[model samples]
Target: MTEHKPEKKVCVFCGSSFGVDPNFSKSASELGVLLSNNNYGLVYGGGTTGLMGCVAKAVASNGSYVHGIIPEALVSKERKNLDEIKKMNEELKESVENHRGATPLDDSYGKTTIVPDMHTRKRMMAQEADGFVAMPGGFGTLEEVMEITTWSQLGIHAKPIVLFNIDHFYDEFIGFLGNCVAKGFISPENGTIISVATTPEEVISKLQSYKVPEGRFNLSWKNQ
Candidate 1:
């Protein structure tokens, strides 16, 4: 039997923590609500903490389908009870529970698949998404987005890769990509493939306007 697929699924890489800036969580929640309203299924690391938890909870609250792929090693370890934030806002308790996937908190919010490792989790998410969104995050987030971008550069897939540069969160990383081009590591033409967005609308716009590279998947430098 064929697998059932949604019209569009976006794999989002974001911080497991909310970060120091309030804008991060705000943007994440907004993006989640907006994506769901636009009928896009959300795929991400299954952590109910930080910005990851914020986005997932918002998506769930807005009545959208959200799927999570997390490594079994991190499931029990990462999805900690965020008591500090929970106490700050009484209403957030419900959101927290929803992310926890606790009984009575589950409401067609979608499924969570616990994989064997991080590699498996990422592969599953990539397989499920038509596009990728990277929010402000630390090392893990950067790693996820860059891997997808590298895959695209090599023509592994034609899916859109975007940076949700909320509050200019990704400015330095964007510059780093340019630096790679300057250093002759990445092609200038290939660098244009990355779409940077400041808002949710821009994220969709970039995805809609994404173009596939002309050449097929390959690596010239490695062979030489």
Candidate 2:
């Protein structure tokens, strides 16, 4: 029997609005291109604006499959970047046919699944991704990264969660984590659970070398 393994898919969490820094956007685009060229699959929010759209377009341009799962309400708004979506959809079609050795769907390549609500969208995105990366973003991006990182700390998942700290956007947050450790909020060991990288190349390399810690385990009932 022939064994088939699915390609590794990375979940990218970023802002729907572009921040003031051009470096962030450029890094996002570069990461997308690198992921595609490196044979890494992508799962992201279906927003075709800001850093989200930038990354998606880069990946699709390089002929990689990007699966975007978005909420129903935001679907139409994302339509503005239809040009990139169109290219991604086409690339997805070719990838399905040639790489996966499967029949391609009539569906467009910027493959998006419109979920009923934000909760479902995030859940589905997390479920589909084998790993995660958080680029420069606002509240939503932070929420996604923190939730997944929390899951990692709880021992519920062992997937690597990396920070795409472009332009030092996440410096304050990283410093807060240290403060948490110093104040006894988070364990010193737990502080190292999340990896940090300043560039796309560093992020990719870190993810590739990531391995689950040997002694990590879930918590037990409180002794109190």
Across 1-224, the per-residue lDDT of candidate 2 in tens digits comes to 12123278899999866789888888999999888767887898865667877887777666777787765454343244445645553322221111113222223325666567888988788788889999988778899999988878877778988998898889999999999989999888888888999999998997898876554568752431
Off by over 4 Å in 2: 1-6, 77-109, 214-216, 219-224
What TM-score does each of the candidates earn? 0.79, 0.79
Candidate 1 per-residue C-alpha lDDT over 28-66 given as tens digits, one digit per residue, 9 for 90 to 100: 989888887777878988666778877877777777777
Off by over 4 Å in 1: 1-6, 77-109, 215-224
